[model samples]
Target: MKNDNVILGIDLGTSAVKCVAMSTSGGIVATTEAAFPLTRDLPGQAEQNPADWLTALELAVTRLGRDVTMNAVAIGLTGQLPTLVCLEGAKPLPSAITWMDSRADAWASSFLDDSKRQMMYDRTGMPIDGRYLAPMFRYHRETFDNGVGTILSAKDFLHFALTGELATDPSTAAGYGLYDLDGANWSQELCAVWGISSSLLPTVRPSASASGLREAVAARLGLPSGLPVTVGCADSVASAYAMAGLDSGTVCITSGSSTIIMDSLPKPLRDSQRRYLLTPHIADGVFGREMDLLSTGTSYRWLNDLLGWENGRIDIAAARSQAGANGLLFSPYLAGGEQGALWNPNLRGVLHGLTVQHSSDDIARAYLEGVQFEIRRCVDILAEDSKIERVVLAGHAASHSATMQMLADILGRPVAAYHHRSPAAIGAALLAAPSAAHSKQMPTDKAVAVPSQLRADYEKIYRRYCAMFPAIAEAAD
Candidate 1:
């Protein structure tokens, strides 16, 4: 039953590596995932040996069965971006930094003056922060002062590994905080400002551009050499492309290790307030309006681990626990910044109205509510900027019925959860396909309607959630 018409999509995410085989008919043939193993090791630092990511990707693709590769016409790559990687061609000079690290803060502050920082934000659609490439690169340039390597994002490294081509997509490049959004290329002025050469970065390429896979790499993975490979986008963008109908009027929420809310506009939207991140979408002239929440699924997973709920058992607690988690209110901030908020990396999680009477179930449910409430807040911000009548939810958090229902009720809008477990990979596959005309990635029939029962209840608690952010800030302080 092996067919050569299938394309492979590789998604290297924060918690895992997922490789999916999708057929020409747009149906998924197989998928496999490998969990994270590399270390955070230090506070404000997260590093992974790049080799581990490749090994994990190989393992997942390998598990898709030998036939998938034998049949895989092309491989599309996507992963976390703005993470630091110093590369000596195919070999990494140092461990790849995860997006979670803030070791670039001092470098960012020293490199960007207030005026230049504002220019960078306006042009790049990203704030001057440690999660960006400029600061991360500066940290390496100042610390090790290494002159032996080039800098690339995680997916760029993967594409280089596969195709021997050092390149990045406009979508990926826009997140680096180095590229010129208006010019759609690397900014020589900014490079001069940072006292760095443009040679340090990858060449810009279209997202769907393809190259022949390298012989050695192909042989290592048991795939044929000269296989076609697509230069894919970042995970959030890919998820939006794969799952959401972004041709105006619709918004997408990719709820995974983080929560990413995005919309598509005819042109890029710049926020002088520095509240949103803008990036080019897969479609020409269309922009992806994006915001991030660092700990959405992570928050839910954290509570699940605390409650000792295994797999599908989590919904039971979340579903049974009434709205407002029985009077317990929670704000999920298990990590650094809760992007789309005040942009405070020091923000902490808060659980108010918690009493001995509340069980772990109540706490878990409360955490779920907290994350969706944050999404509601983000969508509201987006509405102020543009019109969004409907929403499409994708990723791990979106799969749960309770979470979807909660989101729909809280937002008071129709919320469609992606049917596919790996929308980003599916998205990459579409980009890898030989022809642009393919089956519908997201059929409207798959959408779910909002439940009316919980809207009023959630509206009441949502106000309470909004009121708690200040108190949460005080508690964190």
Candidate 2:
């Protein structure tokens, strides 16, 4: 590993494109980001033009400085999963349907009955829903007068833009709700059920498999021509790999707009309750039992806007408020549904026990605590199968030490959070590196210990939260 050698990692996130240039020796050379807009004009709609991702990627790469871009040894790709992008030849449709969109919910709800859903879950390890690519495509076909040419996820589109390859890694392909975990290939029956053709789907490849970059695309980004680009796994998988490798004992929670709680397993492990998603992991032969919180940082950001406070002020106010938010319990399901811990798609947000004594600070604190309580529930579920030796936090929510401490107190264990930039991108960079050099990419992390004083109070609140969730959720529904 030389200091000059670098790997370029790009993450086409929900909100923006985050790019990181890291040396094979584990040092971050440079980082840059380019923001893009998410359109939500209609009900249950969330979309972005596919062109925006490529534009953002080029802009982000240009900001990485010419020297760092030129010295890159390889490029790695990772991003949000299940974002459906339709490509007609080399051009994409007007907009790409993001994972956050739920316009297909009605179709999804009515399409599969209990027996069919159970069969799909047993075979695919994914609790199929409207947010998945197959459902979105079905909805698109029925409503719009467009012909289906090819289907690709967000990162796969980026990979095609850069390397002229129409392929997806297993981790991302699993999000389509058609990949068979046992067969390790696309399920033709499931595809027919969704009315999606197998030929329209992208080819599945290993996450770290490489393709040569297109000369024209490389020239536009000011990088070396014909550089190898590795189509990495989902952002959640990359985040998990960045902090804790493919080991089984560690749980990695990426708390961003949405929170992903996952633990890798040597083989496929399905939940009897079907509460968690079983997906392919960073590489072959490994799988992840995963749970996702639909809204975490999104709730925090919503509160910031509602309260007219700055971005980081919510953490300060949350820290000041006493434990339990003075009995004001908040259900952080502002996303109209939840994924893990409770797989109820009709569930809505609830702010229970609000009275005159509750102030904005209390509301903020309650919501912050609410998110961690949800994480605690998912953690407990993961702990059923794995020992959970350590918990690692990544993404934007890990920046606030006070909130991290609150999480630690709620979970009753120390959590190591990477306070640096995007761990997913760094993880992708490590994947892009030579296989033998992957060990060098584990960066330093900050450990937050549980505070004894708050632990007791959170314990009581957590119990009450667990007891009150069903009633509140039912009422809210």
Candidate 3:
């Protein structure tokens, strides 16, 4: 029989809300998910109604309650980071601006002076990009006429919705471009430069600290009032925590709508070239993490869309039919470019080395290879300072596909696939687990590993793909 003291972890994602209930022994009791749409008003504008997240959270929690015993001890929340959510008191001033939105490119570009950019990067471990918080905040202050009282990231906003408390964890704040990793607080220098006040930001809190929940929210979800809510980290950090391998040499690679490669570091390290970003870990002030963000599974989605294969299901078997993709090479930069190598948004997608012999299968294989090549680039960058011994892969795309074996082989490292369905929720649950004083000690769970057979062939293709990037970059130029 399960214990009455349960912990619930909620992941309020850009596309969906997922909730997981866990027993005190670290066993998953009940899980539920509810999805919402991303509203694209214009070519570059990606927004979501904040009300949608609240509605999804209510439904997901309500569903969880119907299937399980109502004994949630604590709740932890995690989701997409750096998305700007403008709020006036409790209400939203504008729809949540998603992380993918790049309307602030012009605003961000003007601050590209080498010295100023380097200074900001040195303090924040983040580059001056439109996807970051500073640029988004600037956009809101300068463009929006509506009164704005506070700014919260997607997960932070959801936390506020649930707890009626405005706060953010260090992991989420690190990506905002306002956080000073060296100082461990919001940067007054950057705030002054951007002409924004620091008071508008939420209070910074630890990842697992008890963020109080509101009675009204608990009543709506059929949960107990005053349930202890842990201020959770970003999805990547939370996913890393769920993997439970936070040693110095281990890396966590999440291949989903995007590929995020992050590894733990005892202290901050900067490169002369300013390639990678270092962010605070969930256990802030003690550990830091390095990240390389790129489009991974998104490339596959793009190819599938191009082939009109939108049957809403991925046909992996068909993709295996064309070995080596019949010499096709694709550059997977559909949603613009990411870290290390920034490309112009106007740069068109390419299908190089196409021939009359090529088929849809070839395109699919090439698409997969292109994303792997990007991952290899990130791995190479991180290897500059950190000795990455192994990589733990998480996310629906990485867990479901045999193609991930190709990625493991290409990187020449063991790739362990952690729990597939929803790691963010599991990570959140781990974060919300009652303190040792409140429950018995439970053994930590390890991530599930992918088979070794898939790694061999994938390594061969990865080597050839890596050799092809210079020429591809030249072509794009």
Candidate 4:
């Protein structure tokens, strides 16, 4: 039977645009996905067309095959953030500079110094990488004829596309590395340094704030013209919300192209590891500590493509391999610009202990293990809550049994995967729910128990992985 009360949740991810329709009485009634391309046309340049996101979103919603006009009470959205979505009014000027791109490094270096970087970090709750809004503003400022009018993050762009409103929440705003973390507003001095006028920044609002959809957009999408749209948050915060605990007791890991380990923090905090960022959670007075690995699934994909295997898919070959992958070790930093502990933009991925007997399968297993080791490393730095036992894992990359079990054995804690396919999208739906404080739908139940057998071997290999980073990074330096 169809539930009368349903909400549409959409997330714009690096690999695809995902939608989950949830009923108030039932759990997730329907889910849909439409894959989109994230291209690297040049080295250190990751680009995506905003129009493609819109088309993919429409297709996914159509695939849901639900009567949004009758059922969907509200629409909630979330997306990858700090994405430099350069816009003139509602239309994108050209390619959106995604979070993965590092082309703004040259401008960042010229504009920021040791003292200045720390100053910006204090204001933004993160150290500036080339990915932030300020660097993008400075780097590509001269490329446009009219000059870039307004820069918005992925979720912010989606909101504007739906409601014709230019606004963002603190979660996405902080990702730009120019948000006043203390003031909860745009940083005027920081914007001045990057030649970004504060006037161009969107109006900041709390996540879950509401607006009515534009009539034209609603008619085109086959929805009610004045349907309520809840302004949602960034992907990391959404993943945290899906974990079902917005307090200090819960920890969530969103493992995708990048690995993001987040914990609900009570107040504003910073880690000694400069790359570990602090951002406001969607809920008021809640904060999140996010430690990110730039390339987790990206490393896996690269290895798969290098061997000419099926792309965008991981197989059981990794599980068939031994715990240590025949002594092979990999550092999963192939994509450059790591947000993890080292904070090194030039850090390169390394593979050690390859032998003639080792198969491509062993290498694949090593790649998976390598990313897990980095997760353990970053989690140790960002997680202040010491009494935690397990991590709630979302995102497809680390949700696999082999990957989760390896992570469990590595971190010596059970890994709980969301029963639902798209927890991030579900989190967005929660934003639209009447009670954002609770969920009527579901709970995270697919917990991957840690096997004691793999611990001894994994612990030894993990040490070697950690030990090798210094020598390899030094050699590159």
Q: In terms of lDDT, which candidate is strongest?
A: 2
Using TM-score as the measure, name the better of candidate 2 and candidate 4. 2
Best by TM-score: 2
Segments in model 2 whose C-alpha atoms lie over 4 Å from true places = 1-3, 444-446, 475-477
What is the lDDT, from 0 to 100, of the residue 140 in candidate 1?
60
What are the per-residue Cα lDDT tens digits for candidate 1 across 1-477? 377478888998887888888887777788899876757777777788788888887788788888777887888888887677787655786577778776665556566667876888877888767787766776667554455468888899888888888999998887677788889899988777666678878999998888899998888888889998888998878888887635776888887777888888888888767778888887678888888888677666766777777765666677888888999988787776556655665687778899999987788788778888888888888888788978888776565778788888989998887767777887788778777534357553365868678899888899988887856666654
Could you report the Cα RMSD, in angstroms, for every candidate shown?
2.2, 1.6, 3.1, 2.1
Local distance difference test, per candidate? 0.79, 0.86, 0.72, 0.79
State every prediction's TM-score relative to the real structure: 0.94, 0.97, 0.90, 0.94
User: How does model 3 fare in lDDT?
Assistant: 0.72
Q: How many residue pairs of model 2 clash at the backbone? A: 0
Report how far off residue 234 is in candidate 4 (Å): 0.4
Per model, state how many residue pairs clash. 0, 0, 1, 0
Model 2, 1-477: lDDT tens digits are 334889998988988899999887777889899999889999888999988888888899999988888798899889998899998778889789999897887679888788988999999999888999999988887554466578999999999988898899888989999999899899999998988889998889999898999999989999889999998889888888887888789888887779999889998989888888999987778998889998777777888999999888888888888889998999888887887788777888889999998988898899988888999999998888778888888866578788888888999878887766688898898889887677654654745655667899889999999898877667644
TM-score of 1: 0.94
Instruction: Kindly indicate the candidate among 2 and 3 with the higher TM-score.
Output: 2
lDDT tens digits, residue span 340-401, model 3: 34433333456789988777777677776676677777787778787988777766544445
